[model samples]
Target chain A: MALNVLICDDSLLARNQLKKSLPADFDATIVTASNGLEALTVLQTQDIGLVFLDLTMPELDGVGVLEAIKAQALDCLVIVVSADIQPQMQQRVMELGALAFIQKPASADKLAAVLHKYGLI
Target chain B: MTALHFTEEQRDCLQELVNVAMGQASDKLARYLATMVHLQVPAIKLVDTQQLPQHFAQRYQQQSVSLISMGFFGDQGLRGEAIMLYQLANVDVLARLLEYSDDDSSEAEMLTDISSVLTTTFLNGLAEQLDNSFSYAAPRILSSRDQHFADKLAATAQQWQLALQVDIRYQLTDYSFHCDMILLIPGEAVLRLRQMLDQILASF
Candidate 1:
């Protein structure tokens, strides 16, 4: 069975950029959410195995989603793809259980490397 | 009052960092628009918040402009707002570049979207160079029509006496439209950023 993946971001452009960068060889059912609230709904209702999350969004931000995942013990891996590339911000997310953080304008090779590092690819 | 001061070396370092961040923003825009975007060497200034109105009035008087403002926070208590200013007359050109249908309402929406993307990209680029991460709030359209630029800033101008302002001009190579993006870091955040700069300089 193919893995389930979720891409959450408020920008349509950003979501499309990440979606376009996904490797063709990767087999997964990709889902999308524009905000933290929508992402949480998807998480609760779907068996999403991986998520590509953006840090800034309306309604709820990436950190809020991480907190929700931790609170509920959601079974999934999250990799943050954001433009807020502050080191302290990166450390905070890592501490919150994100598998990795990638900077935007996402690239295929970087995405593939992170996935491989976590044995997700 | 002791004027906020930055050593020549510190000023150079900060300017260089802003240059790199602006480069990243320009590249993203170039790719998105599939056109050449020219970025000017940013002019950096440290000024009192109260004096910003005079600054804006002198530089942008009588010109209609749009301002988009967003707040960002760092774990080390570094916080400030990023504001982008565009001439209202350039809205039509911008809409064309972004490939949006030309209309009044869509033009407003396009400005917000472009502002959000540009601010996030630029801030993230700067943070990446400093090896820091920031949490940003959703960008808000502070103003969208012809107005005194300084008046809009006055609404949320309190909280800090000193601020570091970086002014950058983005112009398309083949177009007459241009934008002036100003990044303002308040007194507290400026202090924290200087400390980080010191650490970075020490390592080099």
Candidate 2:
């Protein structure tokens, strides 16, 4: 079974980089949203298994998306890949129910490790 | 060159780059201050350099502020000045947090130190992504006891015809610290940055 993945970020370059870094063996159908609103819209309409989220964005930020997911009781895992790597932010996201946190410019090994730990890949 | 335009994709790319770079800089400041750092999405704009003083006056709307200016240049023809603005009212709180005694010399040292972390760290992050490196001139305090923010900025603003401005804010809610860091990439350097951004986008 393939996991449906949603990569949410405002930057086209960041979206492309993350898409390229996905491990070759990860079986997932990837969708993308430019900002948090679009991300929530997709989550409502599609069966997304995992989300690779970015922190700062124009309309509604990554944290807002996390809040929405929790409020709606949406069933999905979130892994934040953001440039804001403050420990405080990491703690906040984890408390918000994110499965894992990866820093921006995420390496393939790190992504793979997180995926493997959750047994999602 | 070419009206200093950044395409939609280019603009998005630049904003993200600024976001990442600012994240690093603010995180460092947070650790140094022993407080959590909050960041806003960076804003990117192309503006006429001659109007920079007015731009700062209108956007920031501060009567008097402290300004630190630093020059940064890379091997790939990208060079610019980074200006960090601190509200006069807020610096005292930050100074106390850093444990600097209340004195003019101490204030200058503290201001320059903060500027270094914000400017160098951010510029280095940008250069790394572009596969380049930057050298920086020592950061200088542009505002003095009697000088105002806009007046100090006007001296250097006229040198460039157009500038790519990236406005970044780092907020520390705990300490009531809010700073506005702006980067001005002028004329030819703006063209160089556009080309570099395009190459990064194309590589994928």
Please give the DockQ score of every candidate, comma-separated.
0.02, 0.83
Q: Which regions in candidate 2 have their CA more than 4 angstroms from the true location?
A: none
- Writing each residue's lDDT as its tens digit, candidate 2 over B1-204 gives 335688998898888888888889989999888898888888888888777788888966745688999999898688889888888778788889999988989988998999998889999998988888999999999995568778778877777667667777788959777878767777788888889999988877
Q: Model 1, which residues run further than 4 Å from truth? A: A1-121
- Each candidate's fnat, listed in order, reads 0.00, 0.82
- Comparing to the true complex, what docking class would candidate 1 get? incorrect
Candidate 2 A-chain TM?
Answer: 0.97
lDDT minimum window of 10 residues, candidate 2 chain B: B157-166
RMSD of candidates 1 onward, in order: 16.8, 1.6
Which pairs of residues collide in model 1? A86-B132, A86-B133, A87-B131, A87-B132, A87-B133
For candidate 2, what is the DockQ?
0.83
TM-score of each: 0.61, 0.95
Q: What are the per-residue Cα lDDT tens digits for candidate 1 across B39-140?
A: 555678787777876777677777777888889887687778888888877778878778888876787788878877778888888898778888899888
User: Where does candidate 2 clash, by residue pair?
Assistant: none
